[model samples]
Target: MQRKVDPEGLAAAAFLAFLATAGLFYVNIMAAIVDGLVSGLAFTDAQAGQVAAVNTYGAAFGAAVSIFTIARFDWRKTSILCLVILVAIDLLSILSTTPMTMIGIRTLHGLVGGLLIGTGMGVIGRTANPDRSFGMLLFVQFGLGGLGVMFLPRLVPLYGVAPLFLSLALFSLVTLCMMPFLPDYPPRSVAAPIKKAGTVQWTPLVLAISALFLFQAANMGLLAYIFRLGTESGLSRDMTSGALGLATWVALAGPLLVMVLGRRFGRFPLLLAGMLLTLGGNALFHWSQFGEVYLLANCATGITWGLVVPYLFGMTAEFDGTGRTAAAASVISKLGLASGPLVASMMLGGGAGFAELINTALAALVLAMLLMLPPAIMLDRSARRPSELLPQGKVTA
Candidate 1:
């Protein structure tokens, strides 16, 4: 039988997935957010950092909770509730006078955002082409996030911190209005006998999760310090900032490739190539005293950053029909992101130079790529096997 395609449904799902993952993108723009708090709210740098940390920690915890609840609730209804609550929290944040109050409000906001994002990923896992969906997720995030990072801080100087909170509130409200367009995305039915027989492949799942964690940690660690690395490498602040911004916009090509190519070359080959480029990109930091090398390094790393993440998410999502694995991976991702800057801070505090920092990042990336290989190879092998040769109810693409 020929199936009718719901173009509107596909568009709505893609839009919601983009909106729902704003919490993760907010981390990508943490500098502007922290600066807004410091300049507009008159909070000290330490207090602003505390609020951001609390928010990230809260989101991670919320994603952990979602790992258990994804299959129990209606995704559309839950998403609507989360959006409403998030809007309310953002509105409430503007009224917070004390650092503690702001921290508390942002924590609540993060929890709701986390739930929304986790549910969104679960829905993506259920889709026929999660790689493309995840590619779209990164595409929207980088597109909007580049704008935010570039311009949001300018508003803080003129309009106070209200614009930051207002922007977030407005985004959630818009997503809420679009909620009616979303499919219900009810939980899928897993094969009961496979569950009973305990046939799940734990090894590859664990490896993939660990790989994602390391990938995030390595990238965030380098990103958190990229500005300093650039300046110390003899580049001016303006030049570094310009290069970073342009790199961000140029990085859109990576996800665009994923969306267009899908899995044409298989995950393992794509991942290996991406990681190799990442290694070369990091290595370029050694010659960053030359302005062109610095710019190229940032652009290279940025493109690979956009490339590997969605593929990793897509890989993890393939492990389970129920999407629980993807939810759990979201939690790991948040934790890794949160930990990255902390690790970087410790290294800098210990009097380590940028050279040492670059080495550490390179090591983490190498480890991440190694961790990803076994699972990618396993999935590749599974894909090549004939359907009849595989165990019943255990087929994967």
Candidate 2:
């Protein structure tokens, strides 16, 4: 057998993946600041949305490359290169001053983003046993990664845009420093010399990916404009900003709660519960006139996003436990999550209003619920004997 990676070391490696992932999110605040400065060039909300979507677009394309490249490339090498690329992309932003520049840079960033994050998924598959749930592990990554996003709003008041970019640059730098300690996750199987790397069955994986795409699309579509929603509803920026900050702070707890609940109830029910809360929160966004309601919406956002972010990856592994599993997941996210805001932003075809955007998001949410029905039903059939499909290993840390 190829050297079985040490569990302690592997977990440590996974945490570093989280550190880098969180750094990407942390940099998003800078992306937003850059956007504010750059949006003047965008003729329509849709165009501005596309600029935001560039990362997702690049990520999706990059995932396709990962599908082929992961087999031949050293994942370790790819990761380091991508981290360096992230810094280069951020540094290049100083020279950019228009919507096109934003799109191009974000796209490049996403490409590197896809290679780096997808490699982390590939690493997790090779290191862990069949029974190890990716959900909790993925949560740890998202939770840490989310710290950047969670605190992004706060950065605006402290550093302004240029320094905000510099701050994000530092986060990426820290992640890069931590990289060498991570495990090398080559997909090539040990059982056969000249063997093929791990690859997943496509059908169920597609469904699983679709489920995540819809989930993220719904979430991002709404969040892309959430502050605007709050402002329109008469909530002050101070109040709305507090709500956003609190959501990030509390999100770390949501998955832990679900992980505990998952012991008794199935993962599907928690997903349903999360979706419902998200819907309710969106409704409140439409009608809530009070600061407290905005606060509550943040809680709902944090909880649902927290649960869904990691849970989404777990569902992919459930569908297919292969190295390519992460690639499939990344593909779905790129399409649904990346395109979500762009599509949502243009809800009225160049005439979208606040009411229309809310309606679009609500519709997307409804669709997400619908998408879950088929998968949940199928997973239900196997739940009684879930052990048969996933095999067995130590699940919890």
Candidate 1: regions farther than 4 A off: 1-10, 34-51, 68-77, 91-103, 123-132, 154-162, 183-196, 225-241, 285-291, 317-324, 348-356, 386-390, 393-397
Q: Taking the tens digit of each residue's C-alpha lDDT, what string does model 1 give over 249-276?
A: 8889888877776677788898999999
State how far residue 219 of model 2 sits from its true place (Å). 0.8
In order, what lDDT does every prediction score? 0.74, 0.61
Please give each candidate's TM-score. Answer: 0.79, 0.79
Q: TM-score for model 2?
A: 0.79
Model 2 stretches astray by more than 4 angstroms: 1-15, 19-47, 129-160, 183-208, 309-312, 316-326, 385-397
Clash tally for model 1:
0
lDDT of each residue in 1-397, candidate 2, tens digit only: 3443354465555555454363245323422442343333333555556766676677767766766666678876877787777788877764565667767887887787776666655666575452243544545544443454345444555544454455546766876776665555445464521313333435655766777887788777666666556666887656665666566566667777756666367667777887888888777776646888877876777678777656667667656544436556667776776777778656734777767777777787788777765665556566787655445321121
Cα-based lDDT at residue 159, candidate 1: 88
